[model samples]
Target: MQPDWALLLLVANVSTLTVCMVLKLPQIITVIAAKNARGLSVRSLLLELTGFLVFLTYQTYYEYPLITYLEYPVLIVQDAILLMCVLFYNGNIGTALPYTVLFILCWRLITIHRLIIDLAMNLSTFISALSKFAQLQSLWKTCDSGQVSALTWGFAIYTICARIFTTLMTTQDTAVLFRYAVIGVLNTWVFATIIYYRKAGKRKD
Candidate 1:
């Protein structure tokens, strides 16, 4: 690939990932404004936070390209905030602060050793997939699609799609490609569920 083309793809991937990171803002705002987490799943948020934190730690250990994983911290914070809000609304304020503190502390402490970080990274990847499935289960149980932000999932799908293409063109890293491809499929399922439930809810009205 031409140097300019490679640069363009890099920029595009970064931009898409950044947008994905911020896409949760709408849902965050909705939760804050409502003072309740009716449709939100705490389990899902925790899983997301774990995944992001692990990825961040793993990258820090390996010294991978920061731009590629820079959104991890943003996502970690976003999910933490959302989870705190959920706990607060549910009248578990006492547990919220301590839990959040402990979670952050644990992530920080775990980063001190490479061996642990390696294992954690693998575990985090598995948990991330589980988290998505948990979210899907939550949606199925509640039958409420409005709780999760469709835009976030949509942007996720876009980001992963862009990432797969960019990886193929730039690095041809099979591991990265496979990871994003799986994530893309998972995000697609979540996005489709959101649309399905939203339509179902409307039909009942």
Candidate 2:
């Protein structure tokens, strides 16, 4: 018999969380060792942070598991530390335009929607899945390009498995199809970019 879908999703989320946590260690190391954010993209990290916050708001307004709120923040903390190490290399953090604007807009626009805020808790699952997808894509791109070092692809692969599992777990409702599309595009872009870099022999700074 097939396992229960909800159970599968829980298992997948837990497993992905584990892998994400483990993969995160090396990012810390890279920051400390290199003391520069050479290979990392500030825009990507900023986008991820904003995405998670939006999801977190949705979860809280709807009253979903508090844990979902924690996940993205945890990832953000790691990225912030990593950003600190690499900040000087990028010159002013202000140079990251994508990160700045989206992060702010997502928060402001969503917060203003009383309906969205009130219904936030119900959207927790989608938010969690979306944030996870974004972060995983960012990390995979970083690892594939040698920006984050290769000691952690195992973790990344595990995270991808988690995303695949999450996609399976979520119901295929109309609005969600768009969200899934976003995830799919991100996955494709990250993988294709990696392939492009490898073929072109563009060494990561």
Candidate 3:
């Protein structure tokens, strides 16, 4: 049977936005329940937040359609909350103030120079990848999922796939498409690692 491409694209786009609304909730809940940020990487969360802000700024600067980048604000807010949870659990909550100031400065500076936005857009993917790798390293070193929710990473992979589909159908910007592609792979890797370690823990009990 031939696929209904239009319906599929619509579904993908809508699902991507909807899923992103709650993408980080699982991790937040996990950290709270575990009462610690073990196996969660502060570096990963910081990089992820930076990448989100940069990408959001780029799309906004270019005046992209609201639906196209609507989910970013939600994701950014959720990530900031999660980062605070990580810091709070690690007894470094005071440091969040400095990071907040830094984010504000970067947000403004990226807009002052047009060339800066373009540079940020290009570097966004690399920064995001490093975030995922940072998480993976944390998991590998500890051999525990701990406060890193597999559910969150799994949802992230699903959303990335949906975004990839919609990006292909519409804008087809190579940079945006490539960003989703790389992050999708890394999300899957992180999800798989979390699951593997969870199962390993279960086996030991």
Q: Which candidate leads in lDDT?
A: 3
TM-score of 2: 0.60
What's the ranking of the predictions by TM-score, best on top? Answer: 3, 1, 2
Worst 10 residues of 1 by lDDT: 170-179
Give the count of colliding residue pairs in each prediction.
0, 7, 0
Q: Model 3, residue 126: what's the lDDT?
A: 98
**Model 3 lDDT per residue over 1-205, tens place:** 1379878877877888889989999889989988899999999999999999999999889887777788999999999999999999999999999999999999999998889898998899999999999999999999988777888998999988888877777778898998999999999999999999999999999
State which candidate has the highest TM-score: 3
TM-score of each: 0.87, 0.60, 0.95
Runs off by more than 4 Å, candidate 3: 1-4
Report the C-alpha lDDT of model 1 over 1-205, residue by residue, as the tens digit: 7889878888876786678678688878887887777767778778878777777777667776666666767777778777878888878768876767877898987787888887787777677888888889989989998557787788778877877777676557555566676777888998999899999999999
Could you tell me the lDDT of residue 202 within candidate 3?
94
Residue 189 of model 1 has an lDDT of 95
- In candidate 1, which residue pairs get closer than 3 Å at backbone N, Cα or C atoms, i.e. clash? none
